[model samples]
Target chain A: MNKLVNQINDLLLQSIPSSPLETNLEESMRYSLEAGGKRIRPVLLIETLKMLSKSDNYEKGIQTALALEMVHTYSLIHDDLPAMDNDDYRRGKLTNHKVYGEWKALLAGDALLTKAFHLISTDGSIDAQTRIKLVELLSDASGHLGMIGGQTLDMESENQNISLETLQHIHKEKTGALLTFAIMAAVTIVQPSDDVSELLEDYSQHLGLIFQIKDDLLDVYGDEDKLGKPVGSDEKNHKNTYVTLLGQDKTEQKLDYHVKQAEKCLEKLREASYDTSQLEYLTQLFYQRDH
Target chain B: MNKLVNQINDLLLQSIPSSPLETNLEESMRYSLEAGGKRIRPVLLIETLKMLSKSDNYEKGIQTALALEMVHTYSLIHDDLPAMDNDDYRRGKLTNHKVYGEWKALLAGDALLTKAFHLISTDGSIDAQTRIKLVELLSDASGHLGMIGGQTLDMESENQNISLETLQHIHKEKTGALLTFAIMAAVTIVQPSDDVSELLEDYSQHLGLIFQIKDDLLDVYGDEDKLGKPVGSDEKNHKNTYVTLLGQDKTEQKLDYHVKQAEKCLEKLREASYDTSQLEYLTQLFYQRDH
Candidate 1:
């Protein structure tokens, strides 16, 4: 939505290693990392920091962005593994293991996931303590009580109809936790006022919920080419989704309501501190996107 | 060998989780982590920190010890995956996948590895920056230029005789890096004198080599019950080892030489502020242990 965000994304792609020893590893990581999904989490982080303070610690934000992407990509890579979702394709290409063979793909996922914290902690520009906090934020996001926990629930819920609360619990941890971290990381680094931090948390939580609901809706109705994976995948796997539980009309209404709530929270921030327009653009892009 | 070291080990065992959602994940982790290895790396770290300053930082050292063990255990979990070494057993129990199914086992390893950094960074007692440095030390030991790189090479060299130089390179990263990190973490946290830190590195490097050679020796001469895994598994896999490359006698001779070198370095620090005797005892144990 902004030149700064685009520049950060470009720098990220260039900075990640293209090593020979693990060519497939690098390729698979890059494939999904570069796949044209909205760089929302990273953008949210960088923008949140910008809104809170004007500083050159943007490098820390960039590292956080990249690290978040690594975690996201690794989850996608592993989620596509045979024993997991058993998906043959992702983003219109063969999944990592299918292309690289199971072993290297597995190692590549492991490598990317492990390397994420390394990237964040080892970046020289950030203060060491800040870097450590970033790692803490991320590790908590990805560990058992967070993304991994959400994934475990998701795996168990496949082919089985689950209650609304169980579904909410799964999506919140699986998808929302990292998004919350993305927002919180920036807030923590800037050491913003508690009210602003709390407001951002509310905004992030609403946006996160909207994100998953939109995803569920897309699986039911979005075009395959734009989505970059097969449509109806969740249904094929007998997976329960928000749309499955609430129906399309209710899901669409819910998405609209959450987007309004997110925007309402954004109104609490000082108008001079952030280009509220960028966030508005992002929220609109998120909820309205077909993919 | 000391009472304190034993107490630390007990704490480590008690701290690990055994929740029902990840029962086998916990058990698989405990399989290698709880298997009664020498616990040399963590003890070396604690002793090294104490040697630098007998301050109230032993708790930090204990947390670092647990973190390092988590990294070590994570490696073993992945290494034994079907895509990697595919071993059916580790220590005396079934390998991670054999016990928990492959996918969950893989996630268990990922969770354990990721949780390690969280444990250190969020320990609350240590400074965040110091925690960041500790993570850097760990990632450097375990990432591309470190343990994982070493593993990549080792996997590539399987069934093929590798040159001694290559083998040394492999062992340095694969085995020595973490050992070096164990020492370096303490040094970083305690801000040990340069002389002590450098000496500890020298001592740990040799200790690592001695440990590997002893591992090779075990494969050839160790008992299944004592070794906890089948002896000659390496030979069955047609993997080259120091015992095979240099002959059992030469390998033993080399182990003796490394142990002496380690002791010599320890001798240089005999009069340091903290105790070096525990480190010395650990080094001697490396060469003398049967398994």
Candidate 2:
């Protein structure tokens, strides 16, 4: 897992070259991309591909993984803007808008988002049909119908009493969609059997829920030094989360349910003669991570 | 041209449906897109495809054309944000941020940009290879190395002296790249001969310059009613433009030069037995329009 994380970090660092033009747009883009998250999405993508293919020639998935990371990074940058969440720090470092002014950070985010498509489109390892599918899936996942829609709903729900269903819907689209994309993109690349695909999809859905529920849990219960920001920000911002809707104990129970379901899916995969160790480990990490 | 503009407008209107989710993000996106401009970019694309193919079956190019316009529209929305131009109006209507607040406007722009790629990827009329090529070209034209880079240079040059070369370079990327994509996308659709492609490239380059130079001229000498905004905002903003760098007469001369060069490219196309009348008329309109 550490090896895959290091590989993703290296590729991301090498992704956006310094522009010869007289603008720091590239610098601003690089700054956010280099700010260093856990690389969870890309790692999931690569690991899924590896587990399904049973081969180390996961090179074909690298560009797509990078593209997913880029999309995630762009969302973070925009979410940190003053017009959005307005955070000054992320991951123990100054946010993109803090390092590069608001406008530069905004454009940098746009550029990164645009470059993600460029990367997928130009990946020579993939066939044109697969590339098109990737683009379609990615746009649908990240566009208004998915992540952005969730963001809007989340924003509007602020300071208002929201139902449990509404909170789940928001988290499903806002965070689950991209994580599902990571797994599904790998599935798309590997072209598993229909039954296997269904199993993987089920696993991915459970994993997505586990990831977000844990995020809500960590925000209220995790260490600030480890999380790189203060806890209870969701409450401070009057934002609803799983913990808010279900209470800490109930949220923990919900998280356990999803983790068990995700593990069951992995067991099914293993029964079908696929190596599920990497993915099983990922499920545990999402279930137990501090950040 | 009017027919093409109307078609493009209708398509833009139908492109983004209202979200079933409890969010107005879709409305904000639709608002800016429906805030009518001339739809010059899409018209250029369809018209270019029409001229190149010598056939009226330009249906295959419509989605790509819409994609180009979305890219242009997204840039405008981002440009009008408070951190950028902070404009109150566009096309005689309230700018998106003014109408929808700042954060929603930002997300709308991001969504629109993502949808552009979605449009091209899902364009069934074109082959997968063609779709990939369109994605590659569109991203290159709009990403950090192109329009966004130009915008950064433009923003950084505010209140600073810049050379004619730098100013031209900035416009070439900032405004000209997407226009070039308008023409080049048509060429990509038609798969024209190399020589014809080269000629169209030259014409598009000149057209891009004509568009920007005329824009600079219009800022200084055109009527506010025609432009739907104040004329001297460029000067007020301390932004460097062709008019500021070269004065009105020389900027007019520059526009004229590009117009002639664009006409020459069209004449070459005509000699090669392609209908160039539409492009010739567009050149004249760009040269003579007040807005």
Candidate 3:
């Protein structure tokens, strides 16, 4: 897992353009890309590829994985803008907007999002059809219908009494969509059957739930030093999180329920004759992540 | 020209999503996209396709064309943000941030940018390679070292004593790159030869300069009632435009020079056996546009 994470990191570094523009948009892009997060999305993508036994072109998979990270990193950069989350720190360092001013930060985020499409489309090693498929899934997950929509809801839902259903919807779209895409990305590349996709969706949805619930838990109880940022941000922003909705004990129970559900989905996939160990292991990491 | 512009307008309206997220992100996207302009970018793209005789895939070409407009609109939305240009009026209407507030405005721009990739990729009628090529060129133009890079320079060069060459470099990149891509986009779909591409670059670069110079001229001497926005904005922003750098008479001379130069390149393409009538027509419109 560590080796796979390192490879994803290396691919991300290599993917940053070394163009001769006097502007530091590239630098701003690299600043966020190299901020040293868990690399969980790419790791999950590569691991899913391995579990499905479609690991023939590891380099190509890594590029798509890098694009996924680019999307994620760009989201973080834009979310940190003063117009949005106004975050000053992320992953223990100054946010992109903090390191660079708002203008460059905004452009950097735009560049990264643009680069994701550029990378996915130009990855010649991936079959053209699958490239199209990947682009479709990634953009759907990242654009108005998925992450961006969820983010909008997240903002609007702030300081207002919201339903558990609304919170779940936000969770699913805002963060779940991309994490789910991290899995679907591999499935598209592998060209798996529709049956595999159904099961993977089940697994991916459960994984997304667990990830979001655990995030709420960490915000309430986890150590900031380990998390690399303050833990009370949801409350600071008056967000309607799981902890706020269900209380700490109920939220923890919800987290456990989703973990068991995710494991059951993996079990079903294993019964379908695919190795599920790597995915299973990653689920454990998500379940236990402090940050 | 009117028909093409109407089609571009229709495509822009149809492309905006009516999803159920309950935030004005989509509203903001539509607000800016629906904001009336010359539809210059898409007109350039479609006209270039017409000139190159690749009008068979007109629907597919228009989707790419819509993506171009989305890119342009998204840039305008971001460029108007408080962190950037901070303007309250665009195309004679309240800017997006002013209408939807800053956060939704930012997300709307992000969504529009992401949707460009979505539209371009999901246009199944276009072959995979051409789609990939479009994605690459669009990203290169829209990302750093292209539009965003040019924008960065435009921002940085503000209130600074800069040279004509530096100003031109910024204009070429800021607005010119995507205009160049609009032409290259058609050429790629048509599968034109290397020599044609070289001549297209010559044509594209000059067209970009002419467009920027005319924009600067409008900012200085055009009527607000006709132009749909206030004039003297370049001075208000302290932007060192072509008019600022060359005085009114000299900027007019430069615009004339580029128009002639652009015509020469079109003549070269005509000699190379491609009809340059539609592209020639668009440039005349650029030359004569008061708004």
Candidate 4:
């Protein structure tokens, strides 16, 4: 995981522009990118690649992983904007808008998003068709149908009492869709068997739920110092969450349920003779995160 | 031009999302897209495709042309935001934030940008390699090294009283790069000869200057009714434009010079056996437009 995080960090730093005209744009992007959060998306993609293939072609998917991280980072930057969550800090650092002002931070997020597509579009290592497929899936996950759509819904649901189903739908797109794309992009690159691919898809859905639920739990109970940002933001914003809908007790049960389901899918992959060790470890880490 | 404008208007209407979750996003995008301005970028792309190819593949590139429009529209939406331009009107209609508020306007811009890439990535009429190249060029024109870079420069140059060299550098990327890409993307799709390609590159560079100079002229002397929004925004923002650097009379001269140069390149393309009538007419119309 550390190796993958380092690789992702390096590629991210390198992929952003170093132009004199847009140094502030690059600086704004690098500010959030290097703020030392857990590189969960790329780590999941790399681990998924390891589980699915024997050849060290995992190295080839490194660019795609980096692209995933860029999308994640850009989304975070945009999400923390004064227009959205109004977040002042993220991961113990001043939020992008805090450091760069609103407009520059917004452009930084735009650059990061455009640069993510730019990276994949220019990647010579990936064949043209594969790259297009990656773009298709990634765009679907990031755009109106996925992350942005989910975000819109998330904002709309704020201060409004919403159904549990709607909450799940929001998370699936806002959080789960990209996570699914990360794992599925690995599947697309490696061309795994239909059964393996199906299993992985199911695995990622539950993993997404677990991740979101963990996030909700962390907001409620995690250490403020280690978590790097204030908690109770959802409450303050009147935003819906797993904890809000299911209650803390039921949200805990829900988190446990999804984690176990994710583990079961991993066990099934193991039964199919796939190497599931790294994925299993990551799954445990998701359940075990304290900060 | 009317035909292309109507076609673009329809496609823009269709391309944006209609999801109940993001109807506001779609509405915000549609507001700018359907604001009834001249569809210059898409017209440039479609006309260039007409100039280059015979197989009606330009029909396929229509989606790409719409994507370019979306990028232009998205930029306009963001640029008109309270955080950016703080405009109350565009093209005789309310600015997006005036209608949908800041957050939705931002997300709508984001969705439009993402959807632009989505259109290119998922375009089946073009081959994957060509699509990849288009993405490469378009993203380059839109990302940090291009429009966004130009935007950042534009923002920074405000209140700085920068030089003509810096101002031109900013517009070349912010305004000129995408205009070039609209023409250059058609070149990529048609697989034009290197000579024609290089000529169009030069042509679009001149065309870009003409467009920006014309815009500066419009902002100074254009009708509020015909120009949609009020004029003098450049002055209001304290932006450094061609008129600012050269004075109105000299900027008029500059516009004429570029228009002549662009027409010369168009004639060269005509001599090279590529019919350039549409491009020629468009150039003349640009020179004559009062709005």
Q: What is the lDDT of residue B20 in candidate 3?
A: 83
Question: Could you give the TM-score of chain B for each candidate, in order?
Answer: 0.90, 0.98, 0.95, 0.94
Q: Which lDDT tens digits does candidate 1 get at residues B1-291?
A: 467668766776676676434424455556556654567778778877877776545877888888888888888888888878888876666777887788777787888888888888887878877888888788778876678777777777788988887888879888989999998988888886788878888887898898888988999899887877778988898887997789888887888888889888877887664567767767767777877
Once fitted onto the true fold, the runs of candidate 2 whose alpha carbons sit more than 4 angstroms away are: none
Task: Give the number of the best model, judged by lDDT.
Answer: 2
lDDT: worst 10-residue window of model 1 chain A: A19-28
Model 4 lDDT per residue over A1-291, tens place: 687778788878887757878457888888888874788898888889877886545775888888899889988988888888888877777999999999988988888888888888888877999999898899999998889999898888888998998999999999999999989999988888999999999999999998899999998888887787778877887889888888899999888899889989988998998888888888888888987
Q: Please give the range of 10 consecutive residues that has the lowest summed lDDT in model 3 chain B.
A: B51-60
True lDDT of residue A59, candidate 2: 88
- DockQ, each predicted model: 0.56, 0.89, 0.77, 0.77
Question: Distance (Å) between predicted and true CA of A226, model 1?
Answer: 1.6
lDDT score, residue B91, model 1? Answer: 63
**Each candidate's lDDT (Cα)?**
0.79, 0.91, 0.87, 0.87
The predicted structure with the larger TM-score, 1 or 2, is 2
Indicate the residue-level lDDT of B22 in model 4. Answer: 42
Model 2 CAPRI rating: high
RMSD of 4: 1.6
lDDT of 2 by residue, B123-223 (tens): 99999999999999999999999999999998999999999889888988998899999999999999999999999999989999998888888888999
Per-residue lDDT of model 4, residues B2-96, tens digit only: 87789789988988758756446677678888885888899999999988995444776798899899898888988888778778877667888
What's the TM-score of each model vs. the native? 0.93, 0.99, 0.95, 0.97
lDDT of 2 by residue, A1-291 (tens): 788888888888799998878677887888888896789899999999999899978988999999999999999999999999999988778999998899999999999999999999999998999999999999999999999999989999999999998988898889989999999999999999999889888988899899888888888999998988888988999998888888888888888899889988988899999888889888888887877
TM-score, chain A, per candidate?
Answer: 0.91, 0.98, 0.96, 0.96
